[model samples]
Target: EPEVTQTPSHQVTQMGQEVILRCVPISNHLYFYWYRQILGQKVEFLVSFYNNEISEKSEIFDDQFSVERPDGSNFTLKIRSTKLEDSAMYFCASRGTARGNTIYFGEGSWLTVV
Candidate 1:
């Protein structure tokens, strides 16, 4: 069984610094997404990518954030000028098909901005 994998399970950074979270999804998956949860908040959707382009994005994905698939294998999320409010547990997920397909999520990458 294939699963999503994330690097640097936890990251600590200063405010105004930049951070990149990396993830690799199952080889056969087509749709990919990024979601985050504040320490005591509900999980929130950030962005969804498909066919090399952003298919959907939530308000949280503002100018400071970006996502890319530099090598068609690894998906990365870059946050520029991080703020204390940016600290959260970010999850990378992927799905094979849209209908009745299960979305697999990687072990979250915890980001701490202080």
Candidate 2:
């Protein structure tokens, strides 16, 4: 199975700063997603994108957060004005078009806010 890849395996930034986490989904996948785990908490869904547009998003994804497919292969999540509450392991995921296709997650980008 193809896998998703994320950049900046780990990052440390000050509160109120902006951060952009990048990911490259499987080349053949049509659906993409961004999820995060806050320390020991369960994973939380942030947003999902398809056809170059956002298909769904969670309440956790507020104005401070944004997702974009900058190109055919690059999907990115930008967090404006980061906060300590935002510290978490951000995971990039992708799935095929077929129903029930497994969603594969990247190793994850660990964001630490000071």
Candidate 3:
């Protein structure tokens, strides 16, 4: 089965730095989503995109964050300025929209801001 892929499974950065995380969602999926988890914390949804616009977004998607479809198969998330609290597992996910459908997670791009 096709799977969502993310690069640099782990990232470490200094405070106030910038970071760009990459993801390749499933080939045929229609909906793309981003979620994050601080170590030992719960999963939190950040944003969802469909048809090139943001379908939904949570409060956590602040000005420091932005997403884009850079190509037919690649999606990216950029953190303009990282902070110590930005350290966490940032997961990229995709699904076909069934409420009951299982979404695929991209292993995860763990960011550590020190």
Q: How accurate is candidate 2 locally (lDDT)?
A: 0.95
Q: Estimate TM-scores for all models.
A: 0.97, 0.97, 0.94
lDDT of each: 0.95, 0.95, 0.92
lDDT (10s digit) by residue, model 1, range 32-62: 9999999999999999999999999999999
Clashes of each: 0, 0, 0
User: Model 2 over residues 1-114: C-alpha lDDT tens digits?
Assistant: 578999999999999999999999999999999999998899999999988999999999999999989889999999999999999999999999885799999999999999
| Candidate 3 residue lDDT tens string, 8-66 | 89999999999999999999887898999999999999999889878898999999999
For model 1, which pairs clash?
A: none
Q: Give the candidates in order of TM-score, highest first.
A: 2, 1, 3
Which residue segments of model 3 deviate by more than 4 Å?
97-100
lDDT of 3 at 86: 90
